[model samples]
Target: MNKYILNKQQKLTTEKIRNLADSIGIDALGFADASEFTGYTIRNSRRRDPKLSLPEAETIIVAGFYIGGLTLPAWSNFLYGRTSRLYLSGFFLDVVKPLESIAAFLREKGYHAVVCDSSDSERSVLPLKRAAVRAGLGWQGKNSLLLSKKYGSFMALGGIITDAVLEHNTEEEPDRCGSCSRCQEACPLHALEQPHVLKRDTCLSNFLQIEYFPENAQSVSENRVGDCEICQDVCPWNRKHLENPLKTHMTALFQQKIHYWEDIFYLPNLIKMTEEEYESIFKDLNTGIPYSIFHRNVFLAMERAKKS
Candidate 1:
């Protein structure tokens, strides 16, 4: 059975919103109640309550954008520093535009709506993965990433908090990761020693985002310039997506400029790039990577390449 919580007059139906979302290129979407997350797992109040982000919030709309196709086979070559599919697709930040379009649609229908920037964890309105699970979009895998049956972990999540009451799924997707610890075993840093829980401090993805790379990071970082997907790569759920990826509307955009990226991401070319050159190439992408850190990673990747 589905649940529809009424807050104000229903200005829009789920059908209208779904149609708008489909037109806007959102791959997977679901709706959830805006009530505070009451559970032993999510302890942060800000992450729990959508009302904290938007006091008038009555519903949460979660959206996922597939990025599995962005993963390049050439990325594994140490001579060419690799970036996460999330970064390559610019979905880490560009995803806001699509979600904002949905928010705009709700506001046009006389409902208040605000988009949660998926890239900003500190100010994110709600727990996107948790909300996605509640909305029946997917379940949180042992890697702690929201895993869709179709897209796997190669999805970037975004959300909308609105006053509009919408029909939502009452049943959450049951945990499908029974006895699967591939993610835990694959994490080089042992960040996922505990199932469904990531130790952020030890995570290479988190480490690369920071200002200083640890001396020990070079050995494990391999050809990676920014972010890590070792856990996602080894998951059984992601095997099909990894093997035969699907394209989204953004695929055309990627194909158009991927040649430039292919040239620049080569470790030899990347190490010679000035901050201005880097800015010109990546500024519009909004990858959230500073040139200094990225350059350092490239130099390290070059050294690794030489060793190999």
Candidate 2:
């Protein structure tokens, strides 16, 4: 039988959980009814060991927050640059402890609640933007990111899926990206085949993370590094959010990771370090920039810089 029953305590528990999440550094906790998520297209397309995650999450609380601003330091342009992407950086890292704490507390409370691993392999959880939509947080913008009329897509998503059935206070918004194609038009590689229809293989960010680089990219520029935020950057909604706290979400790595590119005019530095060294220096921050990717992008940058 389902372990949880909805009651006044559930309402109080939701508020307490939200309060605790904020105390942990989350900016907002919006609930989405995901009774229909986690099947069909998503389940069949990806493969992840379900044992690595919890099961049967009936109610999902989506978290959206970010860190942007001057505190947003540019990724280092010079090799051995003393800035690090190999670790968490920026504002988002501030909330990790609090997020974890809330999860632990809920476990103690006998609720079958758990955080959806943002990087889960099956990625079985509903997309975070969809979660926001179910919660009435905002409308999905053209970029396929949930754009709060007040906020934007420059946000990170975290969620707690629970067995507690709660009312959905959602007001779905129409796509507000009418006649405006900034996100698509501004894409560096024409990655957006059509609005909300990105050609995944061509997407720079996806390419950086999941696939091998093109032979042609071996000679391309380095300004676009491990992850590309170009599409998100050009959205009219995102543009207006330049000053919003969420725009510059930094994690622990932002405050303390080393960027190395002292002499990129020459491409030989790519060969200067052994793979073992690469693994050692970058092992900790492998969450985003795994060594192979980090090295390949940097090496590619060095190659392109000289050609330019």
Candidate 3:
């Protein structure tokens, strides 16, 4: 094929992929040349090795999904009840399912495509926030979350690494969160060290998901465990968008109604369950929140409530 014909075909293929992604509720999609991320190092964990994860990657297709306001309550709920499980499971399906479909589409077109879930901490190959920024999807906010002008920081991300020589977005998202310290001041654990920098070790959100709670995070209430969103809640960007009536109604539906420790904990039921039973119930709901860790968080919350 002539150079002009080949370029036209590539442009059409890229457009087709974007259209497919949009149809499945992907809020935004962008592509970045994989070469731009060569030798990239992830700061949070030393174990991540991107090159080893996706060998000879030529393009990275970044996908974003705006978290609806109604789902916010479930994410913040301490008890991890039915509503919370639904929201967490929905997130995995929403993000991963679409990437799987996209990867299949790419594979059908004779390209080697590898789908990467944003929640994969074990083999967390690439820094997704950086990939999103490179694709011109958004800028890294002061809170260390990717902030899109349209969706703010309330979004989930996923990506696909492929050998296809796809078109790339040249534009970069500039830092628009100038001098915003609301997220910093809101963190009860004081996790934000500086703009776009985070003390991951001291982060309450990080501590909550791990196997053991940190001693430094003792002051953080157990009710605030499991994906704490205090920083995101206080962000002006998030607040502005959360004012929608639909979201308000949704949040109200999932709002915590149980006041007593016994009612919230269901201590009798939890205590009766065997370790195997507990794992069977919560294993797949949240990627990192295992049964034992969740039980510990519930126990702590109950203890705190009793003390008060």
Candidate 4:
């Protein structure tokens, strides 16, 4: 086949992938060249180069799932230990399924494909936020989260590394977070002192994942038992989402059982919950919190509740 014919065929295949992603309910999609990321330091060379993840990688398919509806104001009662929208919506694990479907489609087309791990950034082969920006999905916000005009920081990102020569997004999303400092100021631990950067050591969201949080984390983690989204909550781009959040297929299902979740996550009830009950309630979701650590967080929240 001639080079022109081969290029046209690749473009057609890329279109098919986009349609499939939409049909599968990916809220946002973008394609980027699988090249070494040089705009920032990733420390890990393997993560900075897509070729390391998939030797023949020529394109990266980035997908975003909106979970704004899950972050709505109703779930913030101090009497209950709360989890982030990202957590309650099961996005950590839910994102893998759609990306895998896309990967499978590429593999069937005689292309090598790899789906990045969705549970943690460290586990992911690509620096997903940077890749998302290059893919034109969004720009990095002051809080170090991907921020889109529509979705803000309410997106759960996932992607597939593929050897297919897909049509790449020519333009990167320009930084729209100009002059916005709300996310930095909103951080209880001042983790975002540097714009578009985060100090993971002082980040409350990071602390919650570990067994022991510091003394300062106690006061700020008043009602939170899992992840924290205060920085995201204060982003000006997220104001619309906060006012009228968008509902995804996954979050819509979670909404139906909000009351049930509220009952179970009530700080007092969580403090008294047995191991079996904990497993039953959280088994399907990919929340990383163990029963013991979860109970400890609940105790901390209950202590703050008493003070309040």
Taking the tens digit of each residue's C-alpha lDDT, what string does model 4 give over 34-147? 888986575555778888888888888899988888753435678878788788767665467667878888889888988886665555787889989989999988899999
Rank by TM-score (best first): 4, 1, 3, 2
Q: Please report how far candidate 3 places residue 70 from its true position, in Å.
A: 4.6
Per-candidate local distance difference test: 0.82, 0.56, 0.66, 0.82
Which scores higher on TM-score, 1 or 2? 1
Residue 63 C-alpha lDDT in model 3? 89
Candidates, ranked, lDDT: 4, 1, 3, 2
* Estimated TM-score for each candidate: 0.93, 0.74, 0.79, 0.93
Which pairs of residues collide in model 3? none
Clashing pairs in 1: none
Evaluated against the true structure, the overall lDDT of model 4 is: 0.82
Task: Compute the lDDT for candidate 1.
Answer: 0.82
The pairs that clash in candidate 4 are none
Candidate 2 on 1-308: residue-level lDDT in tens? 22355589777877887778667666556775545544324554322222234455557777766533322333434332122221233322222334567768777888776665455444334455666776777777767667776666655666666766654555576778888888888776777757766677777666666547786543333544455666776777766555444333243333343233333212355446667876675454445456576666666665555555
Off by over 4 Å in 1: 1-12, 39-45
Model 4 segments more than 4 A misplaced? 1-6, 72-74, 121-123
Model 3 vs truth, CA RMSD? 5.1
RMSD (Å) per prediction: 2.2, 5.4, 5.1, 2.7
